[model samples]
Target chain A: MHEASAATAPGRGGRDLAISVRDLVVGFGDTLVVRGLDLDVYRGEVLGFVGGSGTGKSVLTRTILGLERKRSGRIEVFGEDLDKASAADHARIERRMGVMFQQGALFSNLTVKQNIQVPMREHLRLSPRFADELAMLKLALVGLDLDAADKLPAQLSGGMIKRAALARALALDPELVFLDEPTSGLDPIGAADFDELIATLQKTLGLTVFMVTHDLDSIYAICDRVAALAEGKVIAAGPISTLLASDHPWVHAYFHGTRARRFQDVQ
Target chain B: MEIPDGPTFKSSRSRDAITFELAGRWTIGASAALEDGARAVFAEASKVRRAVLDLGAVAALDTAGAWLIDKTRRELAAAGVEARLERVRPEYGILLEEAHYRQFEAPSGKRRLYAAVLLADIGESVVSFGKDVLAGVSFLGEVVASLLGTIIAPLRFRAISLVFHIEQIGFRSVPIIGLINFLVGCIVAQQGIFQLQRFGASTFAVDLIGILVLRELGVLLTSIMIAGRSGSAVTAEIGSMKMREEIDALKVMGLRPVEVLIVPRILALVISLPLLTFIADMAALFGGLLVAWGYGGINPAAFMARLQSAIGENTFLVGIIKAPFMALVIGIIASMEGLAVAGSAESLGRRVTASVVKSIFMVIVLDGFFAVFFAGIRY
Candidate 1:
């Protein structure tokens, strides 16, 4: 495990960090959701966030994306302070980051091809034919055939929907990708396959993946480091093995439990 | 603080009736104070049948201050006393003319009648007719598209899903529509009986109930009920879906919310409404038949014969024709209100209420327009 950590050392040393969140805090009305959390996602490393329900993992991701305003914080994505960023700056940052939501979140009425072409249409100056070809490429990259591109979201099964959404997310060849609950609601075999896909894509594209998930198998299989959130704070963060070895009861229970043990056996 | 120089008035009969000059920025509150002062000054001037206010020295008097003096003068005139204004400022005089202050000088009885008629017309035409026509046309277009989309979709799975929505919106809605239609039939029959009995024409109550329920009340009542029930549900469903990011998901993937979700729901309602209204008409007639046989001592067979004679096929058709239009309005308005919902659960609640109230109000108003149109036709 330590050797694995050393082998995945931060990434290209001279390149800047992809995302930096320092002493971040977020609240909904009177209740604080995320509190004084710090994290650094270096360029070209898949950083995973894992926690129990209501641990503010999703809220932290939303804050970093500028979708949710932080109460007090500094969030610099590619050296830009997203906290105080203008709409144009936010647009610039968004152009560089791709997001795949849970449930695939595909539009029910549009064909998968149109869905994949959305970012390309918005951020790139490609002709319709060129955009169609690019969408086909993305669909193929996600292991989907071109026939799947013309189908609506409602036509696809759960696994296919997730893959279609991923194809759309990668439409812009984004530097950073945020995956929220990527393996949620999938059967174990399906989830494992998706984890493999994410790992394969990360390596081939040299993309940084910042994923928020509770799926332990996904964390173990794909993530270079795990950030565990609890009670609005980061209780543990670093290599997955370091988190598993921590004295914290939640950490021990999370990484050495029945689910984790089964996942390790599969690996 | 020295007051800016303006109008001055003096009552010759009273030493205490001291009127000060008026000048710049005399807004509503300042005018109110001036009126209070004038009223106080007049309290001691009972013997003085007339008083004159001179405005030659006034630079400007705001609209409210001018209105105050106008009102005071009218009150004095109503008591068979006289008050006059002399040398009023041109700008203030123009303001008074625009507000129609001179109308206060008219004979009280005539003014009262005119005001009553005008108020009634505004209530009927602007508030009722204008809002209904606008809401109805837009809703009609939306409902038609929605219903057609749902009914004609190629996918069997989607069509099956729509069956559940139909059962929820259509079949479950029948009981409420039936109950309301029955009550409406009984009320109309009862009212007809009371009015006709004065002329020993009680049996004609059957004819009236037959025509009213089959030709109008049944459709109107069903539409109102469904608009309240189904329209509000659509608004809340879409509004919550919007808040939950479901609608945003469609937009992110370049899908139109209207073409996808709204069209289907609207279509379902449009197709369901006429059918529901037909059921309501039958239910209402059943209620009327019970009333005729039990309370009015008319045989059920005899009542049916008279009802059939009085309500022609054209009458029934007219009511049925109005059903789809009413349904269209309800669906579109509800969906529009839902899509318009903002950031909170409270917005969902507000939009639901607005959808229901607006749909019901528009349905009744459109019913009146159809009535007028049919009545005006020479055929």
Candidate 2:
């Protein structure tokens, strides 16, 4: 854990910090969802963001992705402050990042292959044949059957939808990827396979993954760091060992819960 | 290093085969020229029994190049030509292999447009319509039973929902219905005056507008408008709720969605359509009276007197009588289509359209039945 932190220190690895959020406050009406939150996600590491249901983990992720308006905050991605970036610069930064929203959020109108090709077509000028071939390759990369390319999102199983969404997220060869509840609906084997794919892709593609999840097994198995969000703040941020030994009441209870204990047994 | 001439191909006919030399960067960046070249090659290859594509001189290749190569081979193979690629780069092999295996040939040549198939389709539609009618009748029975149950236990009735629907379907529709009926009434009066003036009996124009507006147009137009406007809205609202699984949620909570959602909406339509028709009748008569005074130079008093004698109490009652039935048809069809929505936006759209169309058709048909029945009774 110390070595991982050392590797991510400011002077190392040509912009080691991929995303740095500071003093962030997000709210809807009178309810404060994320408040006084400060977090950093290093480049080329998978950061698993965990929270109890309705703890605003997804909200915070959306705020960083520029989907949700923040009451007050400073969010920087790849050394460019999002608030100060111009529209063109913001679009450029956005093009370099990908997001796989929960429930896949696949365009119900498009086939799986067309869904993968959409971002590529928008961002890169390529012939239809190249786009088609690339879409097929991505389908293979995500472990979906080649024939699944022509199927609509409605025709796909829950696991296939997630894989297709992941394939789209990787289509642009993005440096940073945001995955919200990527493995929530999958069975154990499917979830583990998804986790392995993410890990392998992160290593091979050198992607910085900011994942929002409640899957303890995924956090334990693949995440390089885990950030626990509670009480409108990230109360603990470190490796799994650090979170397990934390004194924070919510963090301790979460890591020591029966479900966590079962997962811990196998680990 | 750029490919200055783009991708170029040189083809020549041998004794019984065509040998093509493919060169240059056959990639996406030079897609247009490469596509043209491929087209020319395929066109020339049709005359040969076999073709050899030599790629040894090709500068580079990617997935785009591989797709082109694979497409060319497939096209030739389809034309009964055995096409072979010589000196294929190892980098292009995996892509060509993958692309070749996942053939994009649509399930072909199986669609035969036979008269029997057309007949089968018509029969299928008839059977489907029968099922829909059965479903709608059963749903109407269910709603009636629930209405009776609610009457027995007044506390179980959703009075607020009933009021809201009444406001939505009835109150919101008053101005537009009034305007349309008023315009239609004026047109009818002006046309009657114009034709009757030729016969030196222009005073009889008032009779034409009065009987038509009171006996038929009032209820028919109002019902059609209501079916188009509020009926479509009802189907879309309920269909969306069904799509989002809210209907199932209502069921799990021990509430009958038909009673809670459908009954109130149908009751509102039934209660409002007759009132709207009555209002439309009055508006149409007023418009006709205005045209009679202005266009035909008849006094308002004379017009009112003519209208009074030409349209009897039963004439107005005849139109009002059909209003509730039309309302029931629209309400029943809309709710049936709404509840029938499957798990897609397309289905919701289709059901909404079918609801309005079926309701309007049935409304006009019901009006015809009422017309015949009233004439038989000498009303």
Candidate 3:
């Protein structure tokens, strides 16, 4: 597998990379947020991305999703160059990926079931029976109750919103899913349950997940490899053991910080 | 590489045992093929005593694909035919297990009859109208208490906010109000002259314009405009702030929202409306004077002389006196709707629309009441 960091990660050359970024630079006006960042996500592995509050972990994800413009760089998804692809090719590429925003981003007007069916209705043709069954299947996969299917996003609680958004993201059974702060607003128990859910879905679906999160427990629980962003580039990328072993100041502080110390004993 | 390969099942029967082998990409993309393959498998499986479904040649599978295959297997077994999956890869097995089929409860059926539903809706609206009046009265009480408290403690009053809102709702509205009233004044004068000229009384148009502009048209038009413009603005502003929990934040900060937010805005509305009414009256008179001179052969001197006798002090005061009550009604309705905003953006939008419509309706209704009162008093 092609691991993100060149130094610590063992590279198995033949394995497919789900997402590859080379010398990517993204900025807003004068402030560059992702400077010369290089990263790779192997297929069927959950890559946990870490950063400080303003370090622009989301900016990098948005750049790869083509929602935010990159100043310079190459981003390839499923071996197709995002910049060079035709509109139809880009759409085809997009259909293979799903994104869940931090705020749950479900259409407020649409019911939860309708939200899950949006991607399917847009890209595929299926009978109402199959469509309803699939939407129900997605909701079940996310551990949401069947009754939540009819309720609007505003009616849902924090954890339910996350689950509904995840169900919507998995609407097309996408190979790659981008989750931004998937467990942020959830309670401790809720966060653990969510992490377990992600882990289960990742294994069963063989999905390549790119999760941007500050939840250390989620990083430890579900992530196969963790990458840390500092100074607008990935400073370290490897297993938690490698991150703990790093001498880099930010890396040392992040994993060894007061709040992070709780996990050290557990590990 | 794009694999547009669709699903297919090859079936062969030997005596009573059937062997079915599924191949090609069994994914949601090939939705029709998945259904077709399932149908073909189920059709052949029921006739056999024993059935073997092979997935060894299946190129790809997702949750939807696994769902159809798993469901077909279970249904076949349910029909007294023993069917089992063969050569299922570990990932496909997990996916099949995850996407197992079960009955989902459909939405409840049978809505009420159309006629009964319409009657119920009408009943609900009438009751709601009564509740609305009660709510409006309660809101007026709260606002009055806040006003009294502010009056009692002069230091608690927000003078800066009052000034800012006065500028926002009053001064900024002058140009549009002036322009619309001027056009309306000219139209009324022209129409009056055109009709009265048949009786050799073209100059009588000046008296019509004077009475109409000073007593009814000027204040009514300005109030409606303010209801549409500033009333809607107030609702939208307060509704958004309430949505973001800013009102709650103020309450937690030991300040009354009605006193801080609504009082200043309503006070500004009350102070601005009469001034705007005055401006509207002057603009209408100016427009009438010009129209009489140019359109009806009555010079400005003749128009002014005729207007002085045509309208008394009561004509101007009657319109000016109604401005504050109209302003209060508009302000109360707008603030009430604004405070009613719930958690959703759709709720805020609905509240703003209701604020504008209700305030305009009430303004017109209130004006009709004022006309009757003034007529009874012989004003």
Per DockQ, the best of the predicted structures is 3
lDDT of 2 by residue, B1-379 (tens): 3355577788878799999999887754464566677788888887899999998878866444566777888889899999999887664565466435344433244776799899999999999989988988898899899999999999999999999999999999999999999999999999999999999999999999999998999999999999999999999999999999999999999999999999999999999999999889989988988998999999999998888888788888898988998999999999999999988888899999999999999998888898889989999
TM-score-better candidate, 1 vs 3: 3
As for model 1, its CA RMSD to the true structure in angstroms is: 26.3
lDDT tens digits, residue span A36-59, model 2: 888888888999999999999989
Per-candidate TM-scores read 0.47, 0.75, 0.95
Better of 1 and 3 by lDDT: 3
DockQ of each: 0.01, 0.10, 0.75
**For model 1 chain A, the run of ten residues with the poorest summed lDDT:** A1-10
User: In candidate 1, residue B243 scores what lDDT?
Assistant: 83
Q: Which candidate ranks first by lDDT, i.e. highest? A: 3
lDDT of candidate 3 over A8-32, digit per residue (tens): 3556446788998889999999999
- Candidate 3 regions with alpha-carbon error over 4 angstroms: A1-13, B190-201
Top model number, TM-score: 3
Tell me which of candidates 1 and 3 scores higher on DockQ.
3
Better of 1 and 2 by DockQ: 2
Model 2 chain B: weakest 10-residue lDDT segment is: B98-107
Q: Is the docking of candidate 2 incorrect, acceptable, medium or high quality?
A: incorrect
Where model 1 places Cα greater than 4 Å from the true spot, the runs are: A1-15, A262-267, B1-215, B218-379
